[model samples]
Target chain A: MTIQRRAAFGVAAALPFAGARGQAAQTIRIGVLNDQSGPYRDISGPSGVQCALQAVAEFGSRGFNVEVINADHQNRPDVGVNIARQWYDQGVDMIIDVPTSSVGLAVNNVAREKNKAYINTGSATSDLTGAQCSPNTIHWMYDTYMLAKSTGAAMVRAGGDTWFFITADYAFGHALERDTGNFVRGAGGRVLGSVRYPFPATTDFSSFLVQAQASRAKVIGFANAGADTINSIKQAAEFGVTRRGTKLAALLMFLPDVHSIGLETAQGLVLTESFYWDLNARTRAFTDRMRPRLRDVVPNMASAANYSATLHYLKAIADMGVAASKASGIDVINRMKAMPCDDDAFGAGTIRLDGRKLCPAYLFEVKAPAESRGRWDYYKLVQTTPAEEAFRPIGEGGCALVRS
Target chain B: MDLFGIPAPLLFGQVLLGLINGAFYALLSLGLAVIFGMLNVINFTHGAQFMMGAFVAWMLLEWLGIGYWGALLLAPLIVGATGIIMERLMIARLYKLDHLYGLLLTFGLGLIIEGLFRNEFGSSGLPYRIPVELQGAWDLDFMFMPVYRGWVVLVAFVMCLATWLVIEKTKIGSYLRAATENPALVQAFGINVPRMMTLTYGAGVALAAFAGVLAAPIYSVNPQMGSNLIIIVFAVVVIGGMGSILGSVLTGFGLGIIEGLTKVFYPEASSTVIFVVMALVLLARPAALLGRS
Candidate 1:
């Protein structure tokens, strides 16, 4: 070979090496921000980040690299927004598992402004895809609308026509109560009244329970989540509210809350969710893979949704190639909407144009102590709403993305 | 059936519920009053210690097969010992500084303790079953009352009264009172004021923990349990004035009943009723309801 040809070969080899180095430097960073040390910690704290990492592992990182980082939003919107802004400036492509509605909404706005993707699996507010819908945000898992509809409509159908709510005083609680009340009224039930308790502060629900009892409502719907939900249910049992012919409806409940309240007291309480660990073979397999990493706590719907959403988000990135980085969050989200999402956790689902992930929502009754077979075996599925009917219709949400 | 436009049964039921809440308020505030009146140091870790008490009960049951009755006797001791160690290692060092320093130091300690527990056990609560003997309710014709709840109120009242008598009527309490007035003189007169201070702090923590053990059956045994009650206890201390033990006890129960009545008449203000009363008390008397200027 001529000396000039040998030199050309050397330059060509070094050019590929330089390109690989640049690609390596652009590792896709996914941030998981949620309550890590507060009341919501058990619901979606460090376990949420673990689920994301598991997704990254299962996705194989493809030809590129992926990294998962997390922070404790401490259930504060300002704290969540600051962390999101910092992560976005640091080149984080997506943020996930924001549980609290207040914090989730704040982070959603930040994602929109920063043009970064946000996959929310923790929050329950339908407003995410409603008036506050963002092109950069995709709300996965369940929402208040689904929860109220499944639990409320089912309860009303089962002879609970009069309702009173002991609600947690917050945006999440108000949305839950409003949505559930609408469903109840729509099903020919009447809402007697509702009393709001200070969130994360009121430990004693005896007074609230007494008032609920006096309302003469057959169904006392608890429109709250986390420890507040557990406390209200336990106190109601102790007061024998259920024994005295009043049904306690938990509008929003997690597996951990059921575990905390125990099957004995929590039994017969109706709740709604998009995922349960022991649902089927696929969900069981997914839970089996993630259980060892979860420190014995079964993956709640939020954490399970984290795994599914992260897997799908990675798939979308893989489909978009290296240009995924240059593409705006809306572009990636639009691509995600264009693709069908099929995963072990949620089975077959789709991301609607309004950014609401459509999937089946299950109405579950807490199992009696005699009915539970093993650890974390708490839920008994009563009914399942199909994907098309599970969430609010895309056109009904009034999203600017859908309108346009 | 209507009493002033409200159902008579509802009125009575809420009052019973309020009395139960007041019992807890009185118990916790009395402990805070005792410690503040004696130590001149605000133990911010009182809530964490209370949480520790509940966890100790849970641990005893889970680890050693101890029941709730055994836990009722042992959890407070374990929690008291923890307080003594905390007092010796961290809180005692801040006694020479401003009272705010003591507050800040204990507050940091509280955060550490609470964080450690939260890390060990996630924030979701654990169930503590009521004893089989106390599982039923009392049908008083006027209203139904859970047997366990009624027991809690009676025991709490007895505990608060006993604490008051010991502090106001016993020889050691007089020594404690004297030490609070002039520690240097008490130290010079052959009494170990520092040691008394440590014991007093531990006892106060034990009192809070005792309340926690009592609470475990009613409230879920969780890391943030003490934190939820501590703020209300602080408000109770302010309204009752940290200077008077009896005043703290009475105000705790009084405001509890008032809060219950508020729930019946105006459900919206139940949570803030105590704080609102605190503000009014501060406006009328800056030192507190019974606090000395």
Candidate 2:
């Protein structure tokens, strides 16, 4: 027993020397934190972890070992913050795909304090880049501001001017309603009134739908997401609110939401997104690789963003060499900002001063049942907002990183 | 012209919607009261059974090509049978222990059922189309009332009434109530008290499943569907007195209408309106509205 103990101690003493000699073999740890079993699971759960693995595979690890770990934040801000702090302490270089905006902001603060990177793919609040912006955080995929700019402005331009909002009562929902309201007012549209429903609990939207119908708003904006968004739209159809000619504009929607609502009920609804699986050949290829891993469900914007942002993060690390790990989070983020982001899923894009991913936003109209050719063929692209104009301008964002 | 500073049409329309919500509350709360009354077990799996009812209905349509009418009949039987098996295998074992054990066991069962469904089908809700016959709406000049919603309220009222009649007037209900009062005496009277307990639990579960089928078209059919509605139903049960069948039925509908009215006037308090009422009722009479000492 004593000899065995000595041998174990001898092996442990040699491990450090071996690890020092093979420094290039260091593992790059990436943490994927988001809702794994809640309402947002289908949007960016295990599929998100798979997306990050695909990025590592596509990047070939660049002579360094890449490891990916994931945990379910369960949509709780405290759970998310605790996981993020523990991961940072355990040498996790970055965290990706946090969905809930409240959780996303909490994790962002932890990453900021720890000087680690946080690539936010699931959160929709523009506050991530606005009031809560951090050099260590990258606001990837879509945000409320871009969604409002694409869907809200486009709806007003199409003559549905008068508006009423059935908003989910939360940080993400309020931000979406506020941003969309701004666009409505900016487009010479009249603001009627709005109602805020309890988040996740209020399934029946009949009374709220009645209020919207009575107000006679040309567009009844559903400033909510996931199950809430689908429920509002379905209940609205049942109540005959949509049949009476009031358009239902979903400000924030994902591919999974469209699929769940089905094409028949969701037809003619206009929404804005940063990624669509059928957008182009490159997107199709990326989606093709991810579809089998995602159990037949197509990649939504959040899962797709996981692939794009991780690839770009790796590219930045590859450009910076071994010194990238020791450098502060800001230095690495600055390096990523300097580099042009070109991924198959999102195509060519760039990170702005406010850390918002600059990608062209597409306006998609849900196709009629007769127009759809196959499964997952939901969106028909209506218009493309340029990369520069799609997101909130850097100067306008209240990010401390941006000059006034 | 406005009524009390709000448009008259808006006020009436909201009241109508409130009545519809109340119908669901009544049906679910009635089921809870029935199960708790006989077995003295809270049957925390009520919500999961409700969710299963909708999923089973969807599966019936998807796999067996059964329509709404078929689902309305079949889902309750299937879910009720499952409830019988659960009671015999798991819940029956906890009868000798404290009542808290029964509650904990059923709560664990609810989690297992919800988790299994969520794993099989993702949390994103699947849409169930409104039946073809009940598709259109009635334009009452003040508001457009969907025919299907109207049918739901009418059917729920009739179901609650029928259930009340069965438990209060029938001979079998007399045996069941006698069993609740003294199981030993009911057994002495040649009644199979254990079997009666099993059937009573099954019947109560069937009631919840029936409501689930009715709700499939109105709400998105998802695993978490029953969970959200169950908490509100529990509050309704408490406010009405869990012991009184008619009391639960009344409280359920009353709170639903109050919640609907709150939405029109104070939208923010709509969700918590029932809880607020529950607290007020507790303060006024700790025994609940119709609860016995």
Candidate 3:
């Protein structure tokens, strides 16, 4: 096993520099915003732009011209809001694929304020569909609720009852832990304890791991994403926490993380996602087409969600005419929710009133090193969670539109 | 069952882990201290060089089939030679200028190097495994102490002692110190002062790379790995008294323990404990703990 982490992020073709401003309604500008240079970079980076462009390409230039642009949020809320405002002001009809839940929440507000559409594909916080959902926004892919249900509930059912969390002290981490812990408790499992470490720092997780191990919880849920998740998992083995028969649950692991953490280390890690590149022939065909544009990086669920969401958004635009779609971002979102959507990546799904996308979330276990397969063939599907059972019910989310 | 509501073994495990972390801090800060002391140049590129060491090791292992032992021996040499080139080509020109100039130049260089690596490797980072010889952990009841971490601490202490001995007790060490104090006097005494300074800078860079190599297995070999640890290492060097070699090593280990303890009690404050200590140190002794006023 070689450490050839071939970055799927193609040399950042920081293209479409502040695209031409004239004839605003004629062009449908889509801005793909997320952490392009920080820990979450590979999770969606320029590859998101590539995925968005795949939608534009498949949709073709018929009724309206679609343009995909991207920028780095640097994982900061302020930066994310600023870019969202700029894109909205400069005639970006919709913004998509923003990760970093804090940043995603920040941009969600800006999209609402500026009257532009936001389709969140990168962030994991279920609050986007829950208390904070906006009429102008749609929570495109997987959320914490689904992840918790698919993984935490499964672990509980499998007899790993007690839980402890090593959480990143942030909105995303907090929500993930909260959501997962709810499942563990609701399912008759008890949460022994949890440690909240400072985010974007705290590289050494040995102390936290020690604390978790001492709790002797049957399950140790990592309520963090990106590098924090990778670091915690890598060190978990080193400390022999996993060998002690304690189950490790990566609450928000992305597909890219499996390879980066190495299958040897990531082996047996159970995760939940709505989309996998090798799920079916259509997904494979989609990956094959999008691979060249992405410089051969495999499509993670979020990036693929960008394409799925974008295609659905474009189809809505075509169905309602570009003028009407451009008239109001909320109306566009409403049209999206009203219409059922289907694509090669996520298959068929419908956006709920609370903005949660309906799709079957799959439970997967990371393939061991000896599970001989090519690169990117990391997951083995364990169970399929149908749409209604996959995500939080629309009635539970206190979204004003949903309640009304 | 535990002291102060915490088990003795757990506390000891945390301390050991902290010390292991301190080994890295000592190795990294030791390099920064040497560079600032000898060359009077604030090497902001120190982190980039450290990252380069890890990357070079990964490259050697993946591409050249070099094992960890080979990387420990050769990664620093390769990264250090690049450091030599950097000093000769860019840093040598700013020796007489303001310190800010060197800092800015090195800072910019660090960004460029990090950017280049990020572009090529992407930010998620690659995994470099623990060498086979040191793969397993010793079941110490309280905590499973990984043999790799023990190895890291041992290697770091040896390297730090050897570096201190070379700089403080030897003839070349005296010559290097004299050149830092007064280059003109050293040059007049038939010693090539510029060559000595360049080599000193190279050695410091190598030390950083050494730490990077040591860290490769434990941390993911990513471009951002060095950047994350560098700021704290600088804080360690500052608290250790800029160029005070012994101070840097001592403070690095001390701060690591403190940080580790903070994680046990309040993880939210772990990253801040060092900065808090640095602030207190600055207020208490402007010249730092061990620096000569």
The DockQ figures for the candidates are 0.62, 0.73, 0.82
Instruction: Put the candidates in TM-score order, highest first.
Output: 3, 2, 1
Q: Clashes in model 3: which pairs?
A: none
lDDT of 2: 0.87
For residues A1-404, write the lDDT of model 3, one tens digit per residue.
11111211121122233345444457787878877778877888878878888889888877667766677778899888877887777667899999989999999999898888999998889999889999989998899999999999999998899999999999999999999999999999999999999998878898898899999899999999888889989999888898889999998888888878898899999998888999999999999999788775899988899999999999899889888877899999999999999999998888888888899989999998889388898999999998888988888878888768
Q: Tell me the TM-score of each prediction against the true structure.
A: 0.95, 0.96, 0.96
- Could you say which candidate leads in DockQ? 3
Q: Hey, what RMSD does candidate 1 come out at?
A: 6.7
Better of 2 and 3 by DockQ: 3
Evaluate model 1: give its lDDT: 0.86
Q: What is the lDDT of residue A42 in candidate 1?
A: 89
The sequence of per-residue lDDT tens digits that candidate 3 reaches over residues B99-147 is: 9999999999999999899889988889889999999999988888999
**Relative to the unseen true structure, what is the C-alpha lDDT of residue A8 in candidate 3, on a scale of 0 to 100?**
13
- Relative to the unseen true structure, what is the C-alpha lDDT of residue A363 in candidate 2, on a scale of 0 to 100? 98
Where is model 2 more than 4 Å wrong at Cα? A1-25
Candidate 1: stretches off by over 4 Å: A1-21, B1-5
